[model samples]
Target: MAKVSVDRPVAPSAHPPPSRIGLVGFTTMFVIGTDTFLVAPLLPDLTRSFGVSTEVSGWMVSGYALGYALLALVAGPLSDRRDRRRVLLSGLLAFSAATALCGCATGFWSMVAFRFLAGAAAAFVSPQIWASIPALVPPGRIVRTMGLATAGLSTAQCAGIPLGGWLATVSWRLSFWTVGAVALVVWLVLLRMFPSVPAAPGAAGGLRATPRLYAAILGRRRLALFLLGYFVFQAGNLGSFSFVGTWLTRDFGLSTGSLSAAMVALGAGNVGGSLLTGRVAGRFGPRRALLLGLAVSVALFCALPFAPNLATALVLLSLIVGGVGFMFPVVMTLLQQEAGDARGTVASLANAVMYGGTTVGAALCGLLITGLDGFYGVAGFTVVTLLTSTAVFAASGLFRADPATA
Candidate 1:
């Protein structure tokens, strides 16, 4: 068994403050999340530089999501048996290294290979953050702390890729190198700040967790369907946003600077939505919160194509992105509640499904965007994605108040 210093259990008195722990984890996680969106800005550059078709170039985005999805399934269980700090650090280091490899790539396949590795590294990091929070935070503060963590992720999504976009305008390679450096700095901070905890006995016993866990999760039919529906929703959300920078530049004729500014606006909105989601869920229940959030998202995506100008587009996009803040945390809290004791395993499973949806969306959207270059084409696709996802959730019967709850 691999015992890790960071994974070792500690007495409550020795634990760091929840805010600090969340801050450290958030910083690292933001960097990881940034990696997922980083490829967006560089998509056009990649196509031209590598002399590949747009569809092929999109593998740079889809490949990462696919790799992350596969690894997340495994990383969740491994984190249970190993030190979360070590798992997190290792993932960061790998992400940095792989990103650098992407920066230095001489060919398309080489870039894709490094991207796949980068995604794999990213996969391990998310589970640790989810698993570590409950262990590190007080019960009363967990929701807020998780909200903070979600806020950071939202910032990364809305801000990180734009930074990469701006850097790509300077030199695409510079963007990758810069992010790699940032990841290194976060790794050091995590090492110094976070307390280490040991992996659970189940993970250490070399036990096969996937089949058993899936069986258990599936037995709860409602939970299983909800998770699947959530996966579809996530795929649509990521697919649309992952390449929004590219879309804006191509469709609206916005400069990189303007796009970056718009992204920051989107992040600001996300911060507000994320901050309030926990409160709303606590008061109204996760199901109601989810329904409202998804409805908001559906409306936004529907209106996005019709926005007449850059300013109008930005306003709509910000609300759409910001509104998403409510969906994820609510789902996470529900998953944790549903898991009862096996929180780590459940978190990992839910995350895997979410990213699996992301993978599917990225790849499918990549295909959709090829040869059809206009606002209407992308908008039509996004509307279909949103509507289909919404319909799935509405019909799934997972959004009802659990009778046992109150």
Candidate 2:
């Protein structure tokens, strides 16, 4: 396969310029991120539409994560063995189709099935974008590029819920349809603008080779430790976030409109953090940035239960989300560097670990919330999980600064 160079500026360049590639990646992630987050806000509409209870409708969200987590393990290694462009395009097309099908679902189970399929297809798409960044940009710019991509995802998380809620006022299906259309546009842009990235030299072995490849990647102590830390980190972040609406409504007696407004603050902080992460990581080094963010996040989690009113809780939550935002690109860059030749596989596993963490954290919080303190139990869970993550990072000895770059 011919190599496509990405180092040049966008003046009739043979390779797509880095900026264009970044745009495609950001747009793709924004669509997928929006889809992932939009479901939570639409649960009430879905429950009414399908004639199901809220608890049962909640499966739509869980099912998406479940499918994405399981399939990401498979998609990651498979992309390593093929042209990443092919895997990404194929996944996007399938994801778009599945999302459109979701809008057409006549019952709850059908919606769940389509959501699961959409998530599975999406698992194949995002890891390629993550793995390709190191290949596409100079090392100095890689983290910044990652920050851009992370910002797109973070922005989606910030906007998706409220956007979905507003759209639900019109019709819940409109959000799905809109996402599908946006995905299709992104798919076309990717096909036109994405530079061709060939498979790794030894990566083209068939499905039978997957097990050995994954085993080899997982056997690396640094990679394993980092992944463990990532899982714990996400569990804490998502576990608390998963119940934010419930907490606001139940504890503070905030209405839906007020809750949405509060989430905007949280989302804005996340976007700001993402945009700032590259500079922060560059100055302090990824390890220090990671540690600092983790420390601040833990402090915020501990303080959340004591917030005096709705406004105070929102401010605290924003800061907490911002800390997680700062950590996002730093951890991703570290993981990609550690993965070496198996970056695609490692990227996939990282995503899987995130979803698994969210699932586990949410489940634990659910159990905890049934106690006397309710949301306070969730807050305590966040602190404990974050502390565990910090311990893993410290013990791994991989927390040293990277060599200073220009």
Candidate 3:
């Protein structure tokens, strides 16, 4: 708590206690996650301020995704080569600066540029939380701690979106300023809580060894297939999710306020499910938890297309997202186990594919809806991808029990 002795780098053997580090990791992830959709409600103000069309104004959102997607691939390797605390602190510093800069933007491109910079910096920030959990916590606590960290993201979305929207009602710039200020405070907390984590085994050979380290993971067919499976999984998963808002509006005739309330409810379910996952996975093991969550997700998604009323639709949507919440941390924990020492590389790749999946799923679902009509298209596509992911994970032996980890 007393700054982790900054004059000298603290090694993992002398790392901060698991309980303390876990809280900081959770807080670290929450602060970063809170900023994720903080810009959503500001879009209208942004459009007016920039004198741009709706589509052009969307570049603000697109800019963040673009920056994150592009930088994560690079951030992973860079993270593996140094003390993760250094990477996290450095990244958070940049994130805080860029976020605050958004409130001071002079014009459209400058705002977009600042958003992009914040996002790029975030790519470096969030993944470190994921990558560091294994090194910081005992093996038995890894899955739960990961779940705790994961809950931070879903919970942040539940909390942050509404907070940002409210702040936007006051002033769009106020949202950025508030998030920036929160991030700075979180930075100070992390500076004290996080120790300088030892680099991965791959880091031993220094900069020249980075390529070989990458090749080691790439050369393995199973890991490659697992990544491919994850990519497709994200595509269907995000694709269906992205259209839920449109589906509710078109069919249920919900107003913007109604829709926001519904989304918050769904996010609440997701937060509950994520927290539940840790206990369930801890008791029954991740394999059973994963299977059960996957089955539930498939059923809920299949049933979603048939909801006859707003109540039914909301229940089905909530269930679907809840199931998704349960599955994510288990999948992530399994992936981390597989990665062992190279957690950053895998986290980065997984993160990148996740964004890629969101992109593809959104586009593909749009076409599906055009052809098939309504939520049916999105739900049907999601079901297929979910099933495919199950098969791929099975084939990759991702569900196997690890002797070293619970």
- The lDDT leader among the candidates is 2
TM-score of 1: 0.90
Residues 1-406, candidate 1: write the lDDT tens digits.
Answer: 2221123345578767887977986787688877777787667677788999766676788778777888887787677777778888888888889888889989999888888888888888877888788888876677778777777788886678678878877888888999999999888888889778666554433545555655766677667766777787777787767667667877777776666676778777777778788678778778777778877777787788778888888888878877787677877877777665556666777877877887787777777766576555556666676677666666767566654551
- Candidate 3: clashing pairs of residues: none
Candidate 1's C-alpha runs over 4 A off are: 1-10, 201-204, 207-209, 371-373, 394-396, 402-406
For all the candidates, what are their Cα RMSDs to the real structure?
3.3, 3.8, 5.2
In candidate 1, where is summed lDDT lowest over 10 consecutive residues? 1-10
Query: On residues 116-222, what C-alpha lDDT tens digit does candidate 3 reach at each position?
Result: 88888998988888877767777667666777788787877677765765676667788888888889999999898787776644344344565666678767778
Poorest lDDT segment (10 consecutive residues) of candidate 2: 1-10
Residue 255, candidate 3: how far off, in angstroms?
4.3
- For model 2 the local lDDT of residue 333 reads 78
Judged by whole-model lDDT over C-alpha atoms, candidate 2 comes out at: 0.77
Q: Which regions in candidate 2 have their CA more than 4 angstroms from the true location?
A: 1-13, 44-58, 105-108, 255-257, 370-374, 401-406
